[model samples]
Target: MSKEQIKLRSMIITALFAAIIGVMAQLTIPLPLVPITGQTLAIGLAATILGARYGTLSVLLYIAIGSIGVPVFAEFSAGLSVLVGPTGGFLIGFIPATFIIGLFLEKLGFTFKNAIIANIIGMLITLAFGTVWLKIATDLSWVSALASGFTPFLVVGTIKAILASWIGIIVRKRLLSAKLLISNDIKQSA
Candidate 1:
């Protein structure tokens, strides 16, 4: 395919991943402070499959849409208020988390092992951002924030990380084979 074709395809795929993130955000196990959602899983998938540039782009797109009052966040929440709410840090953190995950895989190659490592790191990044933000946003003590926003997610986040890595690599390979994805690396820029 020509450069324009490839770019168009990549844009479409990136937008699709953004939609996927929104859909996944709806999968929530609600908590008092912050719910457990599949948003992180979709973030991992985007990073592993689309790499940094487009992965980050997908995250930005998701946030932009949600900020515009679309019900795309966890529990179908949205708008600028949601972004600035207690959970906002986690939402904002998805940007760096997705970028780092994709950048790690892009540099290290899209192996399952690498994806796992990257996803784990990304998960931690999200949790850290969320925890800190939760503490400040809610005026909770650090201990409370950890309990509410961080501790509860460790095991679940690990599981989701593994799932994202495994499934992402599988789907990424298939996409590449089908020429929907550019290559094994998927390092194309938007």
Candidate 2:
């Protein structure tokens, strides 16, 4: 493929992942504060499959669409209000979380072990960001924030982390084998 074709392919995949994130965001187990959604899992999948730069791009695209009132966030919430809402930090945290997940995979190779570690770290980062913002936004005590935002998600997050790791590695390897994803360090697929 030419340079333009490669760029276009990557762009399409990035946008597709953004849409996937939106779709996954709808899968929510509602809680009082921040609900558990498939977003973090999708983020992990994006990172594992797309690598650092493009994975971050996918997340940025997802956030951008949601910020523009696309209703792409958890529970179909959207707009700048959602971005600055109590759970906004979690959305913003996705940027770093996605980047770090892909970065770790890029550095350590896209193995199940490394993906698990990366996803676990990413999950904690999201929880921390959301918990702090929840406290500040809701004027709750740190204890309350932890109770509602952080503590509630631990078990589910670990489960999602493992799933993201296992599924991500499998999909990534298949895509690589199929030449659908960019191979090695020379370029990115999406």
Candidate 3:
């Protein structure tokens, strides 16, 4: 493919993942503090498939769209308020989390084991950021922040990470085999 074609393909893929994240954000289990959502799963999948730069771009795109008052967040929330809300840290954390996950996958090779480890680490990063922000945003104690934002999501996050690892690996291999995505694209973007 030409350089322009490759760039266009990458852009399309990034946008697609952004939309996927937005849709996944709606699959929420509302909680008093932070809602549990399928966003983490989508983040893992995007990182695993798109690699670091593009995967992070996808998340940034999602945040940008949501910040523009689009109903793309959990419970159809949007705009600057959502970004500055208590749970916003988790949403912002998605960028770094996805980048780290994609970096590990790219460096270590796109295997099931790597994906799981990367996703686990990414989840921890997200939790840490979210917990701290929850404390700051809500004026709660650190312990309370962790209790409400971190502890509640541990089990679900682990399950989602594992599932995302398996699904992402399978999807990546299939796409690679079908010539829809080039291996170099992943390696180069790392």
Candidate 4:
């Protein structure tokens, strides 16, 4: 395939994966305070497989789609209102969270250990943003924000982070192998 064709294919695949992440956000595990969603998993997967630029773009695309009343968010919520709501910080945090995660992925490369570290750092960034936003939106202090958002998900977040990180590494390796095969076939045909 030509270079342009390859680029186009990559963009399409990235968009598809972004859509998948959006869909995955709707599948939530209900909890007492805030429901846990599979969003971080999608974020990690997108960053790992698509690289930093494309991964961040895919997340931006997801937010854009959701903003336009797509019912893509948790519990089928949508629009700018949701963006500015109490949970809006977490929703908006997706942007920097994905970017930070992808940045770590780019700098650290694809290793299981590095992947785990990347997820931890990435989740920390998200928690920071979410906590700050929660505080402002709900008129609570930092301690309260952390109590509600970060503390509840500590154990489960660690597990999901590990799972997502490993999955991302495996997916990235598979994608690399497939790309090499495609490149070799193109060369042979040429």
lDDT of 3 by residue, 29-116 (tens): 9899899999999999999888888899999999999999999999889998998999999998998999999989888889888889
Q: lDDT per residue, candidate 1, 1-190, as tens digits?
A: 9999999998999999999999999999988889999999999999988888999999999999999999999999999999889999999999999999998988878888888999999999999998998899999999999999999999999999999999998898888878887854534322
Error of 3 at 130 (Å): 0.5
How well is each residue in 85-165 modelled by candidate 4, as lDDT tens digits?
A: 777877778778777777776665667777788777777777777778878888887788789878887787788789878
lDDT scores for all predictions?
A: 0.91, 0.89, 0.90, 0.75
Answer with 2 or 3, whichever has the higher lDDT. Answer: 3
Stretches off by above 4 angstroms in model 3 are: 185-190
Q: How many residue pairs clash per model?
A: 0, 0, 0, 0
Q: How high is each candidate's TM-score?
A: 0.96, 0.96, 0.96, 0.89
Candidate 1 runs further than 4 Å off = 184-190
Stretch of 10 with least lDDT, candidate 4: 181-190
Question: Candidate 3 overall Cα lDDT vs. reference?
Answer: 0.90
How far residue 116's Cα lies from its native spot in candidate 4, in Å, is 0.7
lDDT of 2 by residue, 121-177 (tens): 999998999888899999999899999989988999999999998998899888888
- Sorting all predicted structures by lDDT, with the top scorer first, yields 1, 3, 2, 4
Among all windows of ten consecutive residues in candidate 1, which has the lowest summed lDDT? 181-190
